[model samples]
Target: MWRDPGAPADSFYEVRPECTDVPKSRFRIKAGKTLSARKWHAAFSPEGYLDIGKTLSRIHRGGIHPSIRGEVWEFLLGCYDPKSTFEEREEIRQQRRLKYAALKEECRHLFPLVGSGKFITAPVITEDGIPILDPLVLLETNTDNGVVVPPQDNNAGSTMAPSSTGANLEKVTDKRTIQWMLTLHQIGLDVNRTDRTLVFYEKKENLSKLWDILAVYARIDTDVGYGQGGSLTE
Candidate 1:
């Protein structure tokens, strides 16, 4: 992580240099006011029905505490319905995890960097959906990872991965998959630049996590694919 002398660490919670000129008493010194973990838990019923209105009031009042921020964001993002019961939300999470894993499994062979602790900002496929294997061209400014296009038959250039039959990898002829491949380099680019101001992105694994996220999104929403500056979806 990079040093920010004005603050302890460069992170979402850390105040940037530009924000340092504000009144500390109204901002920096008011950290204790954020919603605490205990209060956050109390907003949920035993059966897991969330007090959406009350929770929103508290959140908008002081923001959420970092300890439970991830869980809170899940609700905010509509990952689970506010009216859903505990058992229902648990089942939703399990199904979502399985679907995501399946999506990643489908994409892993299309590009080597899918789950690899590295990403590439270079073009790995052409407009016509052809694989590009030039190492020099695939290398990014501060990253390293090779592209892996699934194997295809000598006669037919199909991109099917035998998801149902469980056979060897095959070339992808599907337009959706090809579109997903085209967005890989862009995902790497935005991912690398996502939190560059903060030191958290210095770790390749962290960048890879972002890469996997965007890649999975691209795979899921092939119609929209991926776009530049899309990593700000917090």
Candidate 2:
């Protein structure tokens, strides 16, 4: 998960003074009670900011239970603003979803091969319902003939000529879009090779989700590019 758009970058690591205001006795999770939604609401200030020191102290004292760990970690990781009310947080979440969707759409447009599926075997279709063969397929078919097929357009019952040669294929010159595609390719390769032993990463859907998240982050923060690493560390 990404950091909250509203929070300072350093807020994630720095301890806030108010987080320690609670009495030590209240710091730990109550016996047998996990950090439930109700308790989390109680820990926030009326103005919306979470009492980070207090909340962290409580978590440190008792530790989060497994059942609520996913939800609780969202707050810990800055996915949600500690100061936000439930409704406000929900709105933020929705906005982030829309932003991510837009980024994914841009990625698909820039890289025709990119898709949100276990396997992108379907042919790419033009606006007028003509099916454009995947570039990989075209390349394989033309390997012996030495011809490169261009993206075909069949708008309103009209056909466009195929590109002359593979060597003359149109190249993406926009540095940003090219960098994004490169980052996307690297992420897929890394994800596939990094966690071969992990059952969770074995799932195609999980891999796709990881790719989508990294892609969205790359687009959101252009300064950060993909790095080579093992799957777990990545």
Candidate 3:
């Protein structure tokens, strides 16, 4: 014959953190006092059925005895391998690869991020330390020292002769090319140890020395000429 311990009183069960998802039964002894027989009857009917929420309330209120720590950890970790499907893992891997591909595509534009330009300096440093002339024109005559000419100032005289204007324009163009070459060289040097190509070197020293030898070849081979600010893309 079943007997009631008395009126229903609030109770709790002991739940380990490892098995937070599955709580222990409320009928277990708790706090030196077992759950009242009537309370257990309402919590669990005959035929061994259990009410999870009612058990959860008992567990929350510390009404049940605690389980072994190791067993709780094993259950929480899913050591039982309930999801025995490899499909989920494969899907996760595919998603990760897709994410990586997207990132690579986004950053693909930055090619020569740290390498210098490929052209060597075309210079004949005068004993006084000034470049004599444009390096490309003098390549055939002498590779050791390029012609030295003072860079002309267009601002010195606004209404200069045609010859002067032509010279000025040539000088401006040379200066621009040289400046670009130097910038590439510096960036290439910075990324040297990283195994990136600074600039392609000629197999045999060409008589025609200029900054854009490899650059020209790259343009021809790849069919992509230099674009403004594209150097930074490197």
Candidate order, TM-score descending: 1, 2, 3
Instruction: Please provide, for model 1 over 1-234, each residue's C-alpha lDDT reduced to its tens digit, 9 standing for 90 to 100.
Output: 953223211244444444445333222212434566888789889999999888888777677766688999999989889899999999988998898888887767555567667677887667776656465443431223222444545335534221222234344566766777778788777887774544555677888888888888888886777888888773
Task: List residue ranges in candidate 3 displaced over 4 A.
Answer: 1-178, 184-202, 206-211, 216-234
lDDT of 3 by residue, 107-165 (tens): 22111111112222333223332333454523421322222232355342111111211
CA lDDT of every candidate:
0.66, 0.53, 0.33
| TM-score quality measure for candidate 1 | 0.73
Query: Stretches of candidate 1 above 4 Å error?
Result: 1-33, 138-147, 150-173
Error of 2 at 91 (Å): 0.7
In terms of TM-score, which candidate is stronger, 1 or 2?
A: 1
Using TM-score as the measure, the top candidate is 1
lDDT of 2 by residue, 1-234 (tens): 853222122222233354544222222334434455566667777766677777787676556644466677888888987777877987898998888778767754444333444322223333333334567545422323233333334222221123445433343434565455445556666666644544556677877677666656676688766666624543
Candidate 1 global CA lDDT score: 0.66
RMSD of 1: 7.6
- Which pairs of residues collide in candidate 2? 19-53, 19-54, 27-58, 48-83, 49-83, 194-231
* TM-score of each model, paired residue for residue: 0.73, 0.57, 0.17
User: What's the ranking of the predictions by lDDT, best on top?
Assistant: 1, 2, 3
lDDT of 2 at 72: 76
